[model samples]
Target chain A: MPVNSTHYLFLSLLLFSIGIMGALMRRNAIIILMCIELMLNATNLLLVAFSKIYADADAQLFVFFIMVVAAAEVAVGLAIIVMMYRKVHSVDINILNRLKH
Target chain B: MAIYDILFWVLSAIAVGCALGVILSRNPVNSVMFLIITFFAISGHYVLMNAQFLAIVNVIVYAGAIMVLFLFVIMLMNLNADVEPQKGQLVQLAGVISGGVFFLVILAAIKSAKPELMDKTSTNIGLISDLGKVLFTKYVLPFEISSVLFLSAMIGAVVIGKKEETKPLTHNGEEE
Candidate 1:
């Protein structure tokens, strides 16, 4: 049997779901960020798979843009995290209950 | 079928397993390490998909640059496995339930997907030349927009990371 594209997409979906779960349920802010990266990678996988299926290069360009965006996001995100650590002395996201109100 | 397919499955399994480990591992450092594994596996996937340019980029950006930052933060924060808080049983159960539900839904969606196979086989697909052409010709606008976004984010991060000059506290123990 030939390996199919669906199989890769399926794995991507599974990984994305797990990442979402980690982002939602984890108390640590850094872990949540990692999970978000996982989600992004999952989307990247979907894009590359679809690009191959359709024989289009546009999707790869989108992936390039995504990588750029992801880099920017990490720069800003890590800075914010450092600032949060300075004030709170801890990165327990559960303590961010102040945002819920 | 072929050795390439077999290798794909093996690498994908490792990637997915590492991703799952990222979620389940209690230690943040371990989670970061697992994420590195996931990145490596994704690069492997890119290789299998014939996107050689993207595979190398994936390794360079995600695995190399981003993961280094993650590791640096984890070390700077001095996180310890013992410092992890214990979730209440109910909360743990709820997390597990929701995660399992989401996984099942996604799996079902995948099971329902129609498989599409490539018609013509091309080796050395999406070399640096192909990527440069498509990026400049087809997706130029979005590419430029992403660059502007990065610039704005760079400035914002600089501002956010700046150390605030705190005025001395007032007599009432509040910052003036």
Candidate 2:
């Protein structure tokens, strides 16, 4: 009995929930960012699972595009975090009250 | 159940557990580790789907490259275990309510989702040769565009990461 698409969907759901929990609960920007990545990966997994189940390459191709976007996101996001850390001396997102300006 | 079925269940459980750890862990480093485990588990899922190339790439990129960068930056920042501002009541309530709501919504959706019928001829192109052929023949344009996107991102990252010149002189410098 091979793993079915339903199993994949459940995994994606669980992963997405973790990401939501992290983004909501964590005060650290970096951990939140990691959670966001986890969420994106969950979606990608779902796409690949759907593709294979349908015998379609389009969704896998979409996953490829998603990976490219995720890579770019991390690069820019980390740079912003570094710059933010410079001014605040901390990566704790809760301390970012200066943004109220 | 067959061996693959057993492996699938075991791996799925580990993946779900690690994913939960990513959210529950207060330590950022520990969260990052949990995220790594999630990546590995997803890669295993790709393997179960017979997308061998995708599985390897998933592990190599997410678990290998991205995770290392995350760990390096976490260490470089020398972050303390100090609690952040507004860490008391409001955030906890928001976390619980939002997560619970989202989970309920998704669970409802999953319950109603129509089961997808598996392809009778899945053409298990688990081999690199077949996948390469399809990719080059049908998905050539997207592939090329993705490369260009990567190149631009590389340049963008460099520009963004460059240090700002806030001071005209350094400690040992003599400004003209």
DockQ of each: 0.68, 0.57
Deviation of model 1 at B31, angstroms: 1.1
Output the worst ten-in-a-row residue range by lDDT, candidate 2 chain A: A1-10
Best by TM-score: 1
Docking quality (DockQ) of candidate 2: 0.57
Which of the numbered candidates is closest to the native, going by highest lDDT? 1
What fraction of the reference structure's interface contacts does model 2 contain?
Answer: 0.52
Q: Give the local distance difference test score of model 2.
A: 0.80
**Candidate 1: pairs in clash:** none
In candidate 1, stretches whose alpha carbon ends up further than 4 angstroms from where it belongs are B123-125, B167-173
TM-score of each: 0.91, 0.88
Please tell me which predicted candidate would have the highest DockQ against the true structure. Answer: 1
Where is the poorest 10-residue window by lDDT in model 2 chain B?
A: B79-88
Q: Which of the CAPRI classes, incorrect, acceptable, medium or high, describes model 1?
A: medium
RMSD for each model, in Å, please?
2.4, 4.3
Per-residue lDDT tens digits for candidate 1, residues B87-163, read 66777678778877987877776787788874337744468898897778877888788878988998999999898
Candidate 1, residue B101: lDDT: 91
